[model samples]
Target chain A: MEEKLVSLPEAIRAHVSDGDCVVLGACLEAAIPFAATYEIIRQGKRGLDVAAPISDTSSDLLIGAGCVGQVTGAWVGNVSSGLGHNYRRAVEHGEPHALKIRDHSNLSFGMALLAAAYGMPYAPVRTLLGSDILTSNPEFRLAENPFSNGGEKTVLVPPLAPDVTILCVQRADVFGNCHFWGSSGVAAEAALAATSVVLLADEVVPPEVIASDPSRVLVPGYRVSAVCHVPAACHPAPMTGRWQRDSAFFDDYHKRTRERGGFLAWLDEWVLGLEDHDAYRTKLGASLEDLRIKGEALSAPANYAAH
Target chain B: MADYSTQELMIVAAAREIRDGEVIFVGMRLPIAAFGVARLTHAPNAVGLFECGIARYEPSAETLYTMADPANQLGAAWATGLLPMMTQLPAGRVDAGFIGGAEIDRFGNINTSYIGDFKAPKVKLPGSGGAADIAASAKRLLAIMNHEKRRLVERVGYITSPGFLDGGDGREKAGLVRGGPAAVITDRAILRPLGDSRELHLTSVHPGHSVEEIREHTGWALKTAPRVDETPPPSPAELDALHRVDHEGHWR
Candidate 1:
């Protein structure tokens, strides 16, 4: 039978099952596929694990909405600006999920996932050995130094292997061949390590174009199970260039989330009211343009010469 | 009196303290400029160790962007082999550490963790990234913060890093007596250890700032030097070095 190519949701639903570990490539309130993540959360799926470098709205939202059972990474922020109640409730109150490790151990996490994908017994990492992060997280244990010559040296780390990986990209082909201009190595590593890969992209370009420029082909067709070309799907929030996160909307969301009664009411308007990114953008009106301006402003300046 | 902008003043203050050949650990944003300024002026041999593992950074005329910026690595010499740069600080190799804080309490306990409440925070910031380690381990910790009422608070919302739990005795308890924060330089004034209390005493005020102004903004009882000296203005050379690295021209 030939392999299938479907939308992001379908691919996720097909691959992801109960008690399956998942890895996602996301950063701080930037570059995440909210549409797919929202669907995963909506299903109330249990045992859905995640290994991400940094957490933002998508990770927090999933954890908040009871989609994630276990998360192994660092940091979390809410869809509503600044509010961390949802995250606290999910982690502290909801399930009391295990924290795999603390501190941003990206290289360690990457190595572990790679080890799993390659069917290795263990992966060595130089991070978290001397720090308290190793001592704090029980899942990670110290191993005797393989290179010890008469000195006491040990390696400490936990193995990480995700069943599936989901990511959104600026451009891709029909097949799951995707391209990311910014910060490609970590994301690519995560995808390559996962058992299955699903990609969501802004637009589907010709395969020939991707093939001609092989360097641009971040992920090959063979690795990806599905490729969904959803323009502005990662909306209401920004997608680097297509759209930017509405700060005023976020401010209002933040205000509402401060109070319990106000939070539920705001959630009803923002989360429940919108069907998808299209609907969310409609409610946002022309403010999306302002968000674009804000995004440009944030990324453009490296340092403030005067204060 | 020195006529320098806030950023320039900070660079000048930070530059004066660094030695000729010292390993200075710098965080993103303002610290980069301070280190660059130091390099350009007083301490030309001063090696800048970025958190992103870039060591001995020598930026071009226009050095904007974060330390993790790919442009920072361009034509840069990597000391990865000699130092194992990433794990050096935790390994106790760094000499001096510089950090910025959102809020600092009377005891110098910083709170970049939570702005209001942890449960439903008003501002969820980038939590302590080696700040505690740097604070605890570095031979000398130099803090650079913009002077504001909100920042110099009586109590921090969250203790991102324990500065001085109680006072001088606190460091002994935390096992960081040998190396810890020595001086805190803000836009308004410079604070150093007062007496046996370990309480930060205002040693000097910036040219335009007054003793009353520092007292008014502080959340705790402000301490002062018996005789306050006006901070010397940034030299023309210092100003040139500072503006050289500011790619955005915001400092210009």
Candidate 2:
């Protein structure tokens, strides 16, 4: 009963339901779950309310493939590669599909997710006190801090308990104990906050291997509902200790998806066109191998002889 | 005479502005590049706090790998989550941080969200990442951007980062005290808060740029510092380090 093994498509099909407020655990470039995101697109999931504190690949691709209906994000740029062409076209021009946006500073958005993790009604953040993000969004209200020396206006952000939070982790066990290195961004907060978790891991080690070094364990097995083994889960985005961010891939993606027709074409060949992540990786082949490397792990892994 | 791109001049100027042994909260791209150069050249002990939550990170300006990623981020003092580092900004722990926007006004408030209106037409920019938090929390906020008339406007379409709010006592009224935008280092000139107000006044002009041109580019009635200093060209040492860091010509 403790063992939770599922395919990427099975995980998406099992966990991600229609109209779910799906949260993605990502940063500018680290631990971005691009493979899981493509599955959501291939499964033809629709009307998804996508959420991320700061997005680059995960949210952009979902929105591009017409899987997302609304995008609640902080910053939506394709770092180093410039603006996200799909994101720009959606919000600015509403080309392939019209997108609804609720903006927050990356901090405030994390604050909201943190509130849900703590099981609190709202989280009080100080950084958004003077920014227009508070002014523009009516949901973010300035409440008088009762503890404030009388005049301080603190913005009370509501909790964001997403129905699902899909994350890319460095390693996980069959029992779903996930470990991550480098920057977790808001993933730690979002994972605890979400109602369900779909974990996409680069390498699935034995439970003993995950237990060997407990310090690396971020998400406990109990919190994770499904653990799918997906190698190179963070394509384009860098996996800590394993590979560097594929800046060239981002450059090519930006150039290819500049126009609506071209973007749809990319979706055809990459996401919808491919049967699954393995197929997608097969197409990438040698170039994908070039990006692979051995990350600095805490201990010698269980060596399950993964595919 | 040396050939340096306008970006290099600003990077050197920004690095020079950063004092030794200070915690600088830097964002992606240009700010990170400037901090990297600063670490290699002058501020060796200077800690670079990234939005991704690496505290006191020292990046190799030459490799210029993505600082947000820890694998690429070398010589960081501590590897922590965003929670503690993010809270540090509001606690007034950081000495200075870098910020930029589509538009910045005399009051110093910036807009990086929308160009025309909030809910309407025109360009919709990628909203606040950590710039708003950095601006609100840093003890001394350094605003760096390319100098253009459209960018330097009378009033930003929206205030994504609070500079001084309205002017004098505006930031204080909003419960912001310790850190607000102190200076703007751009390609054309260096601007500082005027007198008691947060209004930007040209403190110095770059080697090639003229004060008149700077004023003409500014959206408001730009004032000049009593003794405007001509920004010296980037030293050979600084230029050499900068070029090595930004070998790809991203911010060269």
Candidate 3:
């Protein structure tokens, strides 16, 4: 079996080429690829299109670092932390770089990814008929559903296959069998739709442990290009079972990032200055201890002796 | 006597609007609290679904800032994937939903996307996170928002979520099979659509608020209901539940 483990920088460098369209996992902190996101920023990847059903801090920080030129997402807010400063600056003032925004509703965006995963030409969206999204994006078209009640109206959105997708999960075995629970937003679908995937996990367990509970694995190892053992991968966004969201951090971030100078100062100290995840952890210091929490095991390990 | 803050009253009013046993798809921020209040009170059986895949969730005593907060996801019966979870709304299983926005019009069109022009916005708010989907597909859409003319407007600059869509069968014409803005729940009063006209009319003013006050804040030439009633004050039980769900008053 190929060892899928690699450094976060190596994973990003290998799979994510410049100008690639990347969709970060944004199930509101469930599995945010923040470490990978920071690496992408540190590498100074540019002209990338950032997409999410809800682009929270992950997308906002990417925008802040001038790594993305376009955004294909529904919403880009800090969520519980007020508006995204970089997103606002990009949209309102066009600072850092001019942003090209392709609007999508939460369902339409997620469904498009699902369509791609299902290998469908386009997904029939039941909503957005009356919203400005149909008017704004020509790609989103209205087609009458021939099967439903003689020409029932529905919006047909084209499939979205991102160049790359990165997700942070609670655990993954050496071969990239990823396990995530709780509020899993389009992670599985996005994983399938992406041409390349980088899996960031809190820990990489032995392959036997992963095989023991096959049911717990959401993304199969074959689908993943690289797996990086990244603890606290979803920092500002909490990983389920591992940690609760640091509400105070979000509040502080909101205060810091509201202004451009403050935001840049933050970026310099936290993101740009850190060479790797270890450095980032060292900076986190004692707070990392506070973030740790234990939870009950989710699944039973099946015995191979019976088989 | 009800010991209620304006936020508490707002949450209670919004909660009371949700019918019992309705499948309520709740958006984050204020709507989460309203849905929590509903579940604690009259709408216990109502399904509290989030776009992030939490289903049949009961808000914990701990105040969570976002609907996607892990705390909010704790007691969920099943953490279904996004497709299955989000598809529930458009498949038309959703009876009601709670939504919020920056600006709204008389026809109930909402603008949470941008403040000014699309290309060059004056302010960029988070775009739709299942709000438009809920608005388009829910059998009845209850918008929970604060009362202010700037928010409740005559015409929104951008329409992120379509309500009745310029009124009078606009939603029907647009092929939204079910659901329109059933009511706008605000701190001041509850505004219901006027029959088929689709124009919002002041139905009930919250305790200590007036029809004139709701009218003063509404964007259009607001009309009063045939027999507008004073909204019942939040009961102690309701206030207690609200406080428990929103322990920190983050949204409160």
Task: Assess every candidate by TM-score.
Answer: 0.65, 0.94, 0.96
lDDT of 2 by residue, A1-307 (tens): 4789899999999999989998874455587888888888888899899988776767778878888888886877677676777777787778668888888887888888899999999998787877778767778988787986876777889999899998888899998997787767888888899999989889999887787767788889999999999998888788777766777887788899888788888889888888988998899898888888645445344544439
- Measured with C-alpha atoms, the lDDT of residue A244 in candidate 2 is 65
lDDT of each: 0.61, 0.81, 0.83
Give the candidate order by descending DockQ. 3, 2, 1
The residue pairs that clash in candidate 3, if any, are none
DockQ of each: 0.11, 0.64, 0.76
Best by DockQ: 3
Off by over 4 Å in 2: A294-307, B1-3, B243-252
Q: In candidate 1, what are the lDDT values of residues B1-252, reduced to their tens digit?
A: 445577678767877767778888776556777788888887888877754345765653445333433344434555121114434654667788887778887777676555775544566554454465566556777888877888988777766656675676876553443455677889888887667777877888988889999999888888886877888888889888876767566654
Off by over 4 Å in 3: A295-307, B247-252
Candidate 1, residue B123: lDDT: 61
lDDT string, candidate 1, A188-234, tens digits: 65676777877778778776656655655656878887777666555
Model 1: residue A239 alpha-carbon error in angstroms? 5.2
TM (chain A), candidate 2: 0.93
Which candidate wins on lDDT?
Answer: 3
Candidate 2 CAPRI assessment class: medium
lDDT score at residue B33, model 3, on the 0-100 scale: 82
lDDT of 2 by residue, B1-252 (tens): 648878888888888878889988877667777887888798888887877767655664344345566444545666656777778887878899898777888888888888887776377777788888888888998998778998999888798888988888888888776787778998899999887876788998998779889989998899887889998998888888787778777764
